[model samples]
Target chain A: MSAALQDLDARIVRATQGGLPRVPEPYAALAATLGVSEAQLLERFAAMLADRRVRRIGVVPNHYALGYTANGMSVWDVNDAQVDALGRQVGALAFVSHCYRRPRRPPDWPYNLFAMVHARSRDEVEARLGEIRALLGAALRAHDVLYSTRILKKTGLRLS
Target chain B: MDELDRVIINRLQGGFPLCTRPFAAAAAELGTDEATLMARIEALLGDGTLTRFGPLFDAERLGGAFTLCALRVPEADFERVAAQVNAHPEVAHNYERAHEFNMWFVLGTRAPADIARVIAAIEAETGLAVFEFPREAEYFIELRLAA
Candidate 1:
């Protein structure tokens, strides 16, 4: 959050609903509305991206209608020693769109690492599970693949 | 303006109306006929451009508590931990980001207390820690691709 971006940035960040303007000079249009130059708007967007404040600017579709009705979030409790190597392997899978780990539990929840796998059918998703299982060897004492029965609003983070 | 795209996206975002003649209603709104609209929608879906066209429910409103949780799983137990967390039906989208706290998943429960209880149960079962990052505010990114 640069000082130059503090005010307008917060406003724009707050307005992270709907889709970004779909126009050639979209930044210019936004700048016009914000009382700034197109360059300024573009710079803000670019800077936000550089700072990892925004992950990406792209379309997020409804996977169900596209035939990926069966989506599962897979979680794991990898040993600290092998967490990195195994996490990289799991994350590299094409179907595993997102993979990461969090602090384990005592005061918190257990099952630290997680990954998401999407497939057209449950069987397809399950097949990947088998692959993951084989890769992890006997280390995997417990694992669960929870399928989504319905979507409860899958939209992007609010920016404004 | 690409009239067709505008029509399609607008219709898609609000969600496909669940009716016998849903396409017909959408066509009417777009100033087109049912057949043409259906054909175009079908094409869009076939091309992998449109992910889905249906209801997007509000989980929190539906009496479910959801929070973003992460775990620092060891490599050896990754698969096992994943299995345990996935056992809960409330878990939604999960991600494996490149960070120390790597395993992230969205947890939802019928009651607010269920969220904590479930996390506690998971901790006891797996003998590890889970970092719950409940959403403080609602944020929706507006970044749809124009193709």
Candidate 2:
């Protein structure tokens, strides 16, 4: 990408990182604020979506407000050889929101594959964890679930 | 929240139209008029049902990096340490979990090299070891929740 194009993209992201305006013509409103044509703004947005720089443009619901009070980060110590394959299967589950392969800091953190399980209550979260445990079978070496007691900050990805 | 509100939240989680009149376009598919749909959304936001309603950007995809790090803060100063950690712009998310490594946060920087520097700064500022759990792979990610 050219330096000029990169600069333009960065400016747009920095402007909207807080969020797109909640107005009738949000795109036009944003364009007017940035002093760019509505068409140019839309074109850049489309390109960003295509490249996945912008994941999606929509509402981010507060699960806790909607009764999903329990959020668990369930980690597993699956065999490294089968970790990728197992991670894929675990990720495919309906209840798991985010799943990933993270390195274990042995003796302390022995979990390599991590998955987020969210629900309305502890029982629901436990039940969902059980489903994952059953799927791992003998391959599951060890596991633990860490529940967040509080959210200190959650300002996701900001541009500087 | 009523059935219409739930339906609106479920459907509008993503793929909101980017047009001159997005509410009008989106409301048509939800079987509601533009004015009513806009009013409901405004109420939802005002009442704190929806935290945010807009574009979701990926740090890595946008020429940046993200790293998940955990800190074991002494019980006597959890809040103080959290405030210091969150003071940095790189600390995107900081959560207090029920574990020995209670303070967990994610560091997202525009440049990949900034991650190490921030970790060092945190360690120096708090005098606590920073446990960095860099993500090796992402199997799946879906941020939508039923209302």
Residue B89 alpha-carbon offset, candidate 1, angstroms: 21
- Give per-residue CA lDDT, model 1, range B53-141, as digits (tens): 33232335423566887778787887787778777666765565444555767776667888888889889977888777564333232
lDDT of 1: 0.61
Residue B142 C-alpha lDDT in model 2: 67
Candidate 2: stretches off by over 4 Å: B74-84, B87-89
Query: Taking the tens digit of each residue's C-alpha lDDT, what string does model 2 give over B71-107?
Result: 8899999988999999998998999999988999999
Question: Model 1 in CAPRI terms: which quality?
Answer: incorrect
Which ranges of candidate 1 are over 4 A from the true structure? Answer: A103-110, A150-160, B1-66, B69-147
Candidate 2 chain B, which ten residues in sequence have the lowest lDDT sum? B55-64
Q: DockQ, in order, for the candidates? A: 0.06, 0.70
